[model samples]
Target: MNGWNLAAAVLLGAGGTAALWGVTTGPPARRVIAQNMTTSAVCPALLLLSQGYGRPAYVDLALLLALLGPVGTLVFARLLSDDLSDGPPSARVLTWTAAGAGAAVVLAVCVAVGPGRALVKLLVTGALLIGGNIIASRALADGFQGVRGG
Candidate 1:
């Protein structure tokens, strides 16, 4: 336990240092964003590292988060872009589809590998369904409106 705690502390410290460097090199707004992301990454990693000592599941969670971190960050950046209204309809559809696919993949992986309950998996699936509806309904309605006007 002592060793695990020590390792976690060291990893967190290293992550903080990297975050500091990232912020210092980026623009003002970017610096803040980068710092926040780096910090988010670090806390999860440390939590997993610490939990790895008792439960291996945390290690798997950490691995998934590490793999998906960039995707989340990119989504955040896209949401904050200045020209959000100008993207092509096809491009928007592709983006939303890809995000949905990614979520599906994650849910599948968690179900297959983790020790979570059936209810949790069902909840995740339900959330994905809701999210998909929210995203696609807007575009679908817009297309319908366009056709009606024609």
Candidate 2:
């Protein structure tokens, strides 16, 4: 009802719809990129919802998603490397754009939360989200050849 919830609803609805479409009906590489995008989109929306609902505890959901989303993406990248290796998608623009968005969202939340343990947690989550995103994108692009004993 409020702006935060409305924003979250819009993000979840629009972003999720796009991601689902991309993931469900695209080449393997495109699907991987879409899957990666879902994390960036949903995590921020969850943060907004937590604020909108005035539930600090709800932030935990966002935090966990920020932490685990990339792990899951990496798993997909690793497992599907062979499928992607043929033409490993190079989505540098998309990757950095998503990272920037994640950073912006985390900073916005941190500013709203003010300096404290919550701020530290938000910062950590932002770092993890961006760092993991970059790493996962690299893995997807390169087929993680280095990690694959190549």
Candidate 3:
């Protein structure tokens, strides 16, 4: 496989394994955080795979994941708010680290794509990914009480 594909493969293998392990074997709060991480982990790999395969269309998959991943996490956080209210997990470091990674991936892809409409799409995807991740993490940390009440 080419370097991009190889990199994508390695990332998907390692990150997916870790995310699955964390989600399956953790306490409620930890599980939620891990679930949220899956999006960040997989979206970048998908982006890499798209680049490696020379298929711009595959990028749409990553875009959709960026948009929907956090929504799913937020659903979990809301439904499990009662369970997490006891001492809501604050994975600030992990959250920011994931955001940084997503940002770096998007930036790298943008640089590779250069200035174009595709670049704009990548930027939008990156913004959604990072913003949604942060919002989901905050909801998890706060137990989503505000949302529940309103």
Name the best candidate (by lDDT): 3
- In order of listing, the candidates' clash counts read 0, 0, 0
When sorted by TM-score, best at the front, the candidate numbers are 3, 2, 1
Tell me, by TM-score, which candidate is best.
3
- Global lDDT of each model? 0.45, 0.86, 0.89
Which pairs of residues collide in model 3?
Answer: none
TM-score of each: 0.37, 0.92, 0.95
Question: Poorest 10 consecutive residues of model 2 by lDDT?
Answer: 141-150
Evaluate model 3: give its lDDT: 0.89
lDDT (10s digit) by residue, model 3, range 1-150: 888799789889988998999999968888989999999899989888888898888999999999999999989988888888887988999999989988988888888899988999889889998999999998888776667755
Q: Write the per-residue lDDT of candidate 1 for residues 1-150, one digit (tens) a residue.
A: 555566567656766776787668844444434433462435344343534365544544444444455445444334433322333122345334434534454444344445756336434533543344334333422333333323
Pairs that collide in candidate 1 are none
Q: RMSD to the native, candidate 3?
A: 1.3
Off by over 4 Å in 3: 147-150
RMSD to the true structure for each prediction, in A, is: 10.5, 1.6, 1.3
Candidate 2 or 3, higher TM-score? 3
If candidate 1 were superposed on the true structure by all CA atoms, what would the RMSD be? 10.5
TM-score of 1: 0.37
